[model samples]
Target chain A: MRALPLIPLLLGGWLALPAHAADPADARIATLFNRLAQAEREQDFQGTFVYERNGIFSTHRIWHRVQDGKVIERLLQLDGLPQEVLRVDGKTQCVSGTLVAGVGNTPDSSGRLLDPLKLMSWYDIKTVGETRVAGREVDIVSLKPRDQHRYAFELHLDKDTGLPLKSLLINDKGQLLERFQFTGLNTQAVPTEQELKPSDNCKAVAQVPPQAAEALASWRSDWVPPGFELVKSYVRKDPQTKATVSSLMYDDGLARFSVFLESLDGESVTDTRAQLGPTVAVSRHLTTPKGDMMVTVVGEIPIGTAERIALSMRAQDVQTKQ
Target chain B: MSREALQESLSAVMDNEADELELRRVLSAVDDSETRATWSRYQVARAAMHKELLLPQLDIAAAVSAALADEAAPVKASRGPWRSLGRLAVAASVTVAVLAGVRLYNQDEISGVQLAAQQSAQQGVAVPQVQGPAVLAGYSESSEQATGPMANGVLQGQAGWDNQRLPGYLRQHAQEAALKGTESALPYARAASLENR
Candidate 1:
């Protein structure tokens, strides 16, 4: 009888020990993500990094400063066509290179804050290991997708400041799609105002009045990958084609894709799909009562998911009645 | 063996007309650095005659011979389904290696070759529909083309509807993502990379 009581105690201790060990690991991962998010908002650092994908590679120097609760950042390409972009408090102030016409017309939405708690549902975040990056000891955190809808990410965050020093996007087949790594960093020296100023060549972004809310309400997606939510919706008029394009942006905390719906106006265009490095674009044709519409999905997502999203779009009015 | 006889055997093997004895002679002498140099010189001369790109450093024959040598030993008594399966596995791995080698070789030339192949393909020169190695090679080539034209890191679409709108659409998506700024410099870097093209 005494031996039986001891057996139950031993079993209970074994189970409880695993549960205790797991909870702290989970909490530590969450804490690291939380620190990373806060570091972007509060920390002031400047560094030079190289970004590479299958076909393209470029080096850039970035100067980011936080003052009086506002973030000012400037990015300049070091080699080839000195492209520069300046943003104040996460809003684009100006850009040196040519952007698509009418891109800046949409009303600027405030930047989406990274929510680690929300991201946990879509990605299994874990501290896979540790390594050194840019002469700093770092922790390698892996964000593996729970589904095939998105790609996986390996992030190397600085141990002291929780700043990401290197990031890699890997596809399902374990092939690396893109890489962003900092070659040098300086966290102690704050970037001066002169360094953060935009060059004379930088042209200011043109702003237009926000379109009516109902403009975006005309279309809806019947199905989307789980955990994704509509983050922004807007309609803009194309200058050259004179077509009004409605765009809806969706995000699952980390991964994001945009669905664009434009009336074809009887133009006979074939369906097409293209992949640019880590980004995929799929265009599909849909026949409706009004006319033909071209639905395009573009983002850092799998081509299969983009195609599914393109096919899932429906006229909102028809959807609501059902 | 005399160097002259070995050279003749090497030439015969290169021409794929080697008899069994000549093939064995070349295989045995492949380990000698002098013989290997002679074989490489023969390959370079042959490639030059055919106007083919010469990867002179690639010693595929030696590598394959080494692999076969490693796999040559087996318990003769242990003959059954497992042995056949092992052979099948080896064949599959060899196929995979060839596929990977072809892919790496075609990366730079793919865009141009694909464009010509597409044009000829549309002209009714139907692509061969054979099984085995040819099918695998053809499938990979076509699939690479289907991803669209990426020449010198610049996304250049065939002139048509896609050419008109795809670049614009790409830029808009990238700019939008940069504006979102949720992931800090990543989206911006992606957008800037597009401009470099």
Candidate 2:
């Protein structure tokens, strides 16, 4: 009887050899990514970390202590501008300096969204090794893209809480483009009130009253790497360009990017493209019924991928345009 | 091309003040032996950084110039006294070369001055070829400034801040990403870094 059961087990393992083992890892990452997304909505905890880019390293002090389950985290720019951001819960509560404005708010906290689970299908997640961060031993999770369209990520998860310790944005070449890591962290102790105080430069920014979530403007890519999905899309008029820039943010579970389509209003927009670190930007000149238009795709994706995305932008009813 | 302009671009790049244009210009013409020598010397002095080790003997630009000189010698000898005019010819050629290089420097290899500053643009540069002669939308004609002073490393007054709109867009992009970003603090830190600056 035992032998008979073992035969099926062996056959099943053989039949499902690849994904059988990988399914669990994929499931783990999906869960972790979900948790990480949810963690932003989290209302509590205080931690300190360091951020480095192009080797210009800096340390940061962050106090995110919560009360009555309302999150109040104050992040003081440990160096330089003395900038600060105090957010209550997940919403930006107050800011110092300028609120890099012109993000045409859709007015809905629930509607301004990106779905993470939809992205997981296109990315391969695997546990790489064990490491220490902020005095805590953590598991290294690598979220590698299945396609060349987007960059891969290596994330260090806090072993105790499954929080992110370090996140690295890596290109298809496996080169690290940007790194965000917590050099030190603490969660056991609630941060003191004084730690959350903003310096003089930390001016208060009024909460952008949430507006009604705009209707989900339907858009589909003319071409996208298989398994990628529309994670978010909206239109924001650039104050400078004065053109209605329709944006669509896409994701393959792990990899994400945004596409902005703008009506040129017949303005001459020289098709331009750029790459900064891991983030690749592609702009394409597109013609529509209205007139000449330019489509730009931005985020941590490959140049070719971004170009393809820029080309793929289309009006839903172009055929119906009469 | 005039040694000074080239040197200025090179030094600016070394200081990280050079934008995409300077960087591309330097990289494209880095083949000159004397240029390569100067580049290597800068590398040695730590004032400039060449992405790789430069072998003085392996300098291709200098080698080509040397090869051309060698070929020119026989031609000059064949012409003899006619080429004695060659000494005068060379002096004229050097002066012409300087003028041509300066002209190359000042005159756009491709003109119209409308070329987009080498930017982190998603799409590549637009073709200078305007088949329709159509003035593109958003082209503020009459402005000698193609992309504002920022493209040329000059700030146009508070107008400099007037267009630093990018800094805002960059921040908004970061903050929006952070608010809706997935598991990584990369977006959050990016927003934070922008705030730092």
Candidate 3:
């Protein structure tokens, strides 16, 4: 009798194998993400959104336009300060606020594209459920990290246009770190020239020539979380402090962080770690042969991962000797 | 199995004054729906009395039990009596190292909390008063200058190495991420949020 039952069980297991192997849900989620990427580039819409995190709440209006295969976007804070930013094809053109010294001077480089297929290796992308946002029917997609190195994302995409209507960043403990939700959206009307025009208060970003490459090649990280790749690296000198800071940006397709290396030059600086809403900053003091160096890691990643990355930064020559 | 006895045992468990027998009695009754409801009610009442934020859905006890069940047992290496003293010495050194590490970590945490307290206190004093709608914009702008060092919402204004460099580091990171990121306006919003007073 046991043998007789075993035969059907084996046959049933064989029949279920193919269905489990080819999961349609994964394929559908991948398609939705691909559509989301395309929608960002092709869709032109005007919307107002509220960005909220711990101790800070602000509302903003965005005007995104696609003209001749270029993406031009403008954002203005609806609340205090009336802060405005204008971008032409993802490169910031100007801003109303004071720019950080020694920033926005990098040579123009292509923007990082969202690749759902590549991101799947690090995050488990799945459609959790459906919801309505900004008076539009939407699908709720959750991107959960496979490892504890990064935070998870919950995205609500419009069913018709696939544009993200709401995005929430959640930490490992399931607490929401930050939220971006649209209060109103108009997809039918293309943003006009008058709406796209930045106000006179917006100052043009000054461009400086790229610095020499040798400074960037001097430092390297001994270990980073698996799947994170070095996406960009640059060195800039602070005009005020005159400190030469070299920054290396890393991303695992979905989440990103940057490692900034600056020499302390015998200055007494304590190592510090801080969390600003969804972003975490970790600094470690390193005593090198030449002098002391401070390695600071900042990004939308977990605090432990940032600290580990900060600790793992090593000079290029030290690795060669090993 | 009397209801009154079970209630007493539940209260004992809640107060953490339960003996082995009382704990066992409460654990046995926990499977019943009525007992579970009573337990949760007691939890809410206790939290209210203590003025604690009660997360009703979080059953830390059950989670801890599950974690303990799934934890692997430690494997022991074969040893002789001669090596026992050496093993003891190694263990002692490991304990010393761990204690030293914890002391260092605690110091770092205490300093971090003190810095945050100082920063918030300064921000409280620096917050500009709201006069009118017309001056609101100008007031916020002036407040930004008054709180420029701590305006980024992370650093303390203490004349130190971090106050001078961290804001620039933070802004550079944000701007670079905004320029390179293709996830639409999210990055731009983040960079912009940093600028908000």
Candidate 4:
């Protein structure tokens, strides 16, 4: 009798092992990421959240509403400063005075949605467990980085809405580099138009297309960490310095970094590396045939990785016409 | 000095109007946790008004004090540059160095020490080829503080060539992040933080 029972148990165990060995776990994780990416854009809700890194902590109130197929979002800082930003249809309509000033004129580049297939290649996404955040139940999902170049993220996403209520950026040693978590959430009702209106202090921004410079296309990064891809590149002249700064931005779907190359114009500047909260800025001098250019890399990455990215930056020599 | 007087001195310091006596007074009490908290609050209020970027919790005085404490043994006996400055001047210099370090670049060349500022970012760097450009001049890294100004979590405008250019770079990086940011309000917060005085 015991043998008969053992036979079924063995069969059950054997059946489950292969099924688990396949892509079901990966498929589930991908589905969760897809839902999470879609939720923030499609959903209409309001909440209060806090962002913290190192010794700095700031609280904010966010009201995201979608009406008539247009998404309007308003964010206001709760402490320290009354900073505010209002975006309509994924483009910034106005911003609190002095925050972005003249920089807001550039055409907005719509963000890349979280691609599960690409993300799977760099991160091992798994359903860790369940937890409660902001008075709502959430499923804990871990995006463990497969390499050392990036940090791991443990996201507590709301079960019903699939919105990330709590997210933590953790280093390999388990040190928390930065955290973004909601303290309160309300998904029941959409925010009103009046609530989304820019404050009196908010100034409308003008969008100016960057002047076309052919030199930007000639510059390229000789090396970048695996899984990272160049997302956007452009050249813009500095209003203050009057030097054309060529910028290249790269992203690994989740992590992003920007590289800026500006000619010194005979002004000597030493190489520098500084870390601000979770963001690291590294400036290195690279001598190109055009001139001595200052290459700076800024992003939310480890200092070593950033420095490597800085050193790996190389200018492509222009081919002479026959 | 009385507690109220010390508070007034702290305020005066934040406003950049404090005399020598008031500066010394605030430095003495800066060790106390309450005093530090009050200092942070004042910084926050001032930063908010100026629309300046600030890391409210960064205790520059405390980091200086820790740096001083670590150097206690050798300071009393040696006639080194630090010893020549005297105790009072050393304390004052600590304040000035930490504050000014954020906004100024070294005119004189300082060898870039790759490992010096690697305080917390020393993990997972497998490639030895990418050690550092060199120890940069004016790049102060006390035992308690990381890469001085940058690690302070705030951007203060320093009237220098590099200082002027740095803000543009920081803003461009931040604004680009915000524009391309589909993740959440994190990028937006980062962009906003850059605007403070």
Give the CA lDDT, 0 to 100, for residue A40 in model 1: 82
lDDT of 3 by residue, B33-90 (tens): 7998889889999998999946888777667877988998555554555379677865
RMSD of each: 11.5, 16.6, 16.6, 16.5
Candidate 1, superposed: residue stretches over 4 Å from native: A1-22, A105-108, A320-322, B1-159
lDDT of 4 by residue, A112-185 (tens): 57776777666777899998999999999998876667778888989999888988877655667677899999
lDDT of 1 by residue, A143-172 (tens): 888666778999999899898899998766
Worst 10 residues of 1 chain A by lDDT: A1-10
Model number with the top TM-score: 1
Shift in Å, residue A113, candidate 1: 2.6
CAPRI grade of model 2: incorrect
Docking class of 3: incorrect
Worst 10 residues of 1 chain B by lDDT: B126-135
**TM-score of candidate 2 on Cα atoms, chains taken together:** 0.59
Off by over 4 Å in 2: A1-44, A104-107, A110-119, A197-220, A226-228, B1-169, B181-184, B195-197
TM-score preference between candidates 1 and 3, better one: 1
Candidate 3: clashing pairs of residues: none
Candidate 2, residues A37-104: lDDT per residue as tens digits?
55555624567677754334556677766577676677766777666766655555556665544442
Could you give me the TM-score of model 3 versus the true structure?
0.68
Top candidate by DockQ: 1
Better of 1 and 4 by lDDT: 1
After TM-score superposition, the amount by which residue A198's alpha carbon in candidate 4 deviates from its true location, in angstroms, is 0.9
Q: Deviation in angstroms for B117 in model 1?
A: 24
Off by over 4 Å in 3: A1-22, A105-108, A208-212, B1-159
